[model samples]
Target chain A: MKKIIYLLILCLTTSIFYSCSKDEPDTANSIFDTSAPELNSFDQWLRDNYVIPYNIQVKYKLEDIETDYAYNVIPADLEKSKRMAFLLKYLWIEAYKEVAGDGIHFVRANAPRVMHYLGSAEYDDRGKRLGVAEGGMKITITEVNDLIPSQIIYQEFFNTIHHEFGHILCQTIDIPIDFRTITPADYAPSTWFNRSDEEAAELGFVSPYASSLPEEDFVEVLARYITYTPAEWQAKLTQAGTTGSELITIKLGRVKTYMKNAWKVDLDQLKAVVQRRAYEIQFIDLDNLGF
Target chain B: MKKNSILTIILSLALAISCTPNIDPIFEKSASERMTESVENVKKLLTAQTNGWLVEYYPEKTQKYGGFNLLFKFDGENVVVRSELEPLRTDSSIYALKGDMSTSLNFTTYNISLHRFSDPSLNIGGGIGLAYEGDYEFVIVSALETEFILRGKKTKNTIRMTPFPTTIDWEEFCQQILDSKPEYRPLYLHVNGNDSLWVSNDETSLTMSYKKDNVEVNKKIAYMFTPQGLKLYEDFEYAGKTYSEFILQSNNNLISAGSTFVPRVPPATWLPRAAFAGTYTLIHYTNIGGTGTPYTKTVTLTEYDNKFLLSGLMPSLNLDVVLDYHFGKGILLARQQGLRYIGGNSLNLTSVTNEFGLSPGAFYIGQQVSWDGVSDPIELTWTDYGQYGSPIIGFVLWFTNSAGLSVGQYTTGPVDQRLWTHIKMTKQ
Candidate 1:
């Protein structure tokens, strides 16, 4: 009886050991450590720090994880994955404060989201062929790879959240007709092509990249207005050349006026906040995680 | 001993159980907790990979392209691109060869304009609209009304009234207006070699040395702004095509907004209406020399939003009148009104100086000056020897702002010489 009992105990131990052993691959270990915990400590951190502040939460099934290039990227390791989540959450909080201001943070509890392990795949180049979003369910990121990078993870988060929220704004209201008149007939993609910095400045764009496309142009203005100092933009405009400077100045003026006249938000204050946040992040000891 | 063994077993079992809780193979989180319902959001992502901004797809399942660089800002309502500079690059294949490549970009001029159309032939494209901020060089090619056949759709593009790209001779015209001095004021005319007012090629004649001649002219002169608000010399042109010259002059005015008055005498001097009003006038002659019946007509002026539209035409006789007028902001008029008879059936307002002979056509005088206020003119004295055969001409002048709206007049030396002379008049 004693021998039989010993055999049974050994069998159980062996089985348990085998099961636990499968979880310890060195390759996978390098992928994620802190992010692999049951509740994903990084996500918990986000919930505790970011989601509540912005009044938003994300939920998703593990298998339906979506990734996009702008706000997500392929991760290099578990540590990197954790860093990315932190960055995204941080950016979310920053964008929220910059755009929505105080007392405007709250989201329904049941929004859907697809939690992704930071080191999974490139949001645009790999993994699932869809985008990441929160509808009304809790999400889990089981895998970790390249689908989320730190820079992409942050910038894209800021952009996507803002853009999606912008859609919400539009769905609920309409913009003025005059805003559409500023784009002239000759605005071309080539306008951005091969233009020198001096020339681009004359044209009233922050950079050639801002001049690359109209959507970018608009978003850059929005980002600059909601997050940066108006003086910074104005200075940039003043430094721009003849062809595009006037247009940019006019556009910026219109944006400020629109924010005031339409949304009734104190955009200048928002601009101050943006500048402050940018300064804070720029000076933060991010350990070389520069965007 | 039994109790102690049992306690040890229980403790070990508890540890084992606690340590072996199955950690499901995947770390999963529910999707609903990550959304924010309290605040409006604008997801303005600058494309990281540069495939262009993702617009919506109709099917909701498939990815589609829309040519609009959506600026997801609080434009009081939704996120949208306000300018063509923010145009979304759509699928280029839908339009033409450039369309496909264009769709890959985030912003392009074509995406904002012609790319909106699915058809190639129907892209009339947006022209220089109200927001136009830069200089444009437009060369009038041709005018026609036609229906453009779009891809299974047709569009019509038409241009009704437009001006061909022609340079306005501003300098010479201004100088001539400056040369038309008011009844008693001395005037000086500055003729630049590069002056657009006159077609003269020699720069030497524009210098102070060209002013040595002393001469007189047939009519007194002054300066004013035009009825259409341009600075010009109000004078008549009678020598060139008889009635043809009059028709050409009228056609030119109508084409260029009916704002220019070409001088008849020197032929080089042109004046805007206001300058003509403040500066020069034609001495009306009722058959002073011969038996060609005297022509007369009563002219009436009506105001059209600060502009005077001359009405009533006498069909039979070519009549001339000496006139004076007042002009305020937005007002325009000329100083002199007169006529010269063309030999046959037409009479034109011209500057033909013949003391006893009947002029072929009736000539009219107009002066154009400044409406945006005038700049102090430099006091300059010079003589032109060329005017002696013609007559001694004197000038006085004033500039209206830096855009160089100058008002002045010119005259022949003492009216003793039969020279086609002018003087420059300065703004008072």
Candidate 2:
């Protein structure tokens, strides 16, 4: 009887342990919600233009995960954002489309995946950050609260967009060594802010901030040339007296050669196209998305 | 017989465990599924409100800044927000309810009235890292039809939104708050019956500070004014009890659950700061033998922001002295403020830059005789009469080479009691 009890108990316990369901996963995909967002007029416009054509996402609504928490920033104004979206497509996206080798395809391959907007500028002890690019994947534009159409070029917005975009291009193809060698001795990464614009011009760099690094210098020279008029370029040369001017001309020649050889981009043609589009934008209604 | 019974018991217990294996989940749906449903339901409830919702919003993670009453009316993807700060202004913006770990309410577009608190550019504390530290995105912790409990995504402060009544007027409600903001009061928190906490409620920082164990406990109790009373950021704990709302009593004093915010001095009248701009009669005595000389001065007082220039005191010097209205003392404390330029809102009014304080401490205090209600001041008595007792000369001023008040340091003038100690200004 003792043996019978022991065997029965052991068998029953074993059955209890082994009893389980052999079920497969109900769904192959993640259980997380991955639903499509409802598109309004502006969203749909962004989709047709930036999203579908260039595979880009213009995030106007401020998202904490998307922005840098290092600086305090607010959302861009809806009305201003609406105006800016149209202008960006016209002045920036379309400007590239008109110039690049494969046009929109070229933009699709190289352009930032996301373009974020902010109402106010992020100011630090040094100064304000107008635009910042992240790993050639995203670009954040600030101070969109005061976006005036005609004054876009005069202010940092257009120049900053071009500057950030130039960084993306340089990242794609490394900046030529000759360009870096022209102002290697003049580069002051830490104390570049202490140097004035006129002083920077006299030291073979386009702007004071351009003397920070070779990468920054490369982008600044490319962006300034693309945005500035021939007269504006000449004025920079004028300020860069004799030796400084000679260094700047050498650097500029290398930048032009790098763009032509590396990317097949004509700097002067891009400038003319941008300036002409900017001039014609005076009559175009920025608010009209043309959806 | 005992062996057989043990065998049966063991077998029965094992069989029971085998038959009843745990597989059923506690909830009917997954947490993500429930969160999605909850977010959808919240969105529906937000848009379904007839009047809208009243949000008691406190800025910053620590709740160290000010609190604001934000009225939110959600309709589809758009939300129109009104605030107590800007009573008349209304701003509309787009919002989206998306579920991540929890459902978040994001104000996607710029609503100036709402985003001003969150704007880092409007730095109240210090650094680019610190603004009001308000949140544009809020996590809906628990959503309901009547009320929604929220926490800021960045600020991480508990924010509550209750359904606003359709009958109540928003503008009027905001106006009532303006009338009831207790500015610069010597407040006390009555703890039980025997003990009380000496508190300082400052309007500038929206902070209440008290001393405990020789260390100052600065509590930034961000509060908003309602028609009923002042609503604190969260439940304020004192004497082992928590109180969120302070109701205004018949005595016009605010009372919380176990404590009362009893002011040492009566609150200033609800009259606007700009209302104290008019002519007045200056009565003063220059010498001991001098009678309270009444000088009829009919000059329209021009105001630059809150400070006003008061002249006619020491008329021989031809002074344009600046006077600050000390509402707590019911007196205008003489401030050594100077004006630099007057070109399109460029006129500066600072007490530190005493380029215009012709003489140091040459100003006088004009205390209101009565300040109990919301009305224009009727009479102002000279309170600095015997402040600085008998000096030979109250002030001797220096001018620049070009014959204007020069930039330099200035100490408040000795309001010499012996000279002009008896001045009474009655409003005309």
Candidate 3:
């Protein structure tokens, strides 16, 4: 009877322990919110690739779609999200081409979900941030209620990607300290708006929009590199009352040097790739929108 | 008991492993890194290229305009240039070049010409019976040594030169010539010369001369395949006074003739090529400036290809000026019309006898192009200015070709009675 009692107790305890162990929530499914069917694709991709394959632990509730992807605030509207994703992909391609030679690493959704509009350094609520090893990155474009029309959705998405991804590169490997030094002391929040065009010109910048901050300036320069041909920049300088000849030479020289010395990347080959990517996904059909 | 203990241990290990959460390190991009990224982004957004022109004019109607021609044989190069007048014509062809010269090379030849219609018969029923006998060659070469003229009572020396070089050291040259007269402001060689060498005596008499060997080739002038007439003076001192003689001939003729001669008096404005800064308001009646009160007029400036357009006003005579620029040749083609200046139709101001009050003219360095040999009526647009100090109160003109297009704008000058017009050009 004593042995039977002891055996029974042991069995009970073991069964209980096993049951408890089984209850350890499947982290892969923990982040999924069935109610938000719109993120099904995103969630699935993250699960199979991001979460399971890469074993990345991400803190994001699929149910709270409003605050997610601040850069894209269409409330997980499938069409809008798709569009934003497309534009982001375009910008990513564009930005990637200058730093990385060719081809981008596309991650599965579960690998590590990117949360939009969360970081303090982010420009908007949807500003972007990245996870290097496991989870990917988060980029925010706008507030939940501030969803833009499809007409400008692509541009806005591109801008957010451009801005947020800027942070990724900065964080991945430190940019040269000298780059910050040339940015000037007045470089701060909202400088792009505060300074006049002429003021910007005095500092070797193209427009005040490029004068926002050191970070923003970097992105703006990159955006221009992706969008404008050297000849085009030269033409713009002509409108500014000077040939962009010298400035162009200086700019190209600095860009090449920065990419190689600081980022250990080849810029020329990147330019070619970025140009190809941009050609694939630029905001061109806006003219048709009016029709 | 051992089996139970082992099972418990296995269960505990499983629970511990399953519950453990792995967090990924947040990656942050540095500013320099961001710059690299941004640069990467910029490389992605792209578009195309645009172009235009800028021109400056001198006091004596001499003009020099430098700009990039978007669609030309000389694409992507700054074509700085100047044009002058030949003795026997209205304006000479444009002397275009590739680069800017720091020092004046030497103004020996105004080898620029254009074919224009000077038909007096088209208006007054018939007079000089002037017809553009095909293309005529016109050049603004140096004033012949014998081409000196006695303008006033004083022995003021004056010579004829085409559109002169912009920079000239008159004082230094004057000191070398005459120790008596203190050199005033260095007069610009606004017409034809690599460097204008001018010397004057008592009055306003001026003599401009250049050597035959010091001529720099004008690229713009060469582009046009037209006959250009050239006349130069060969002046030598027979006695105490200077006597100069000149020969009127085409550029082809000069090359063909190759002879020299002496003269008795200085040559004034005798030109197969006109002086770049000649003082001549030849045809004048109730001058536009004569109207004491200012009036208003509207003008339309059109391009040759009918693509470029600009408009302005004229305040005094209430006339309109239609201005156009030949992008290929860098010429300012203008047409003037009075408020009541009309004839058969089409801005009839082109007729002088009808008092049409129109001066249809083309500004060039003296060269011509073969274009169906009849009087090629250059089309122009005009406007009038009624208000005082109105900006751009004149005309704008345009010209287009397979290469590209250009525009010229004219403004009313302060000299009202003088019918002064300032011109501006830009590429399109």
TM-scores for every predicted model: 0.27, 0.72, 0.28
RMSD (CA, Å), each prediction: 31.9, 11.1, 32.8
lDDT of each: 0.32, 0.69, 0.32
| 10 residues in a row with least lDDT, candidate 3 chain A | A118-127
What is candidate 1's lDDT per residue for B209-259, written digit by digit as tens?
Answer: 122134322322111222222211123322221110111132222112222
| DockQ for each model | 0.01, 0.32, 0.01
Model 1 per-residue lDDT at A158? 44
Can you tell me which runs of candidate 1 are displaced by over 4 Å?
A: A1-37, A50-73, A76-95, A98-102, A106-175, A189-216, A226-235, A261-264, A281-291, B1-428
Could you give the fnat of all candidates in order?
0.00, 0.64, 0.00
Tens-digit lDDT track for model 3 on A1-291? 557656765776676556544445445443322354333454464455335633433222212222322321111223334343444444454345335532233223211245442111112221222211211355444422223434332333344444455456655655555555564654646334444455565565655555666655665565555455557566556544553334434554665677676555576665566556556444455223211
What C-alpha lDDT, on a 0 to 100 scale, does residue B157 get in candidate 3?
Answer: 17
Q: Rank the candidates by TM-score, best first.
A: 2, 3, 1
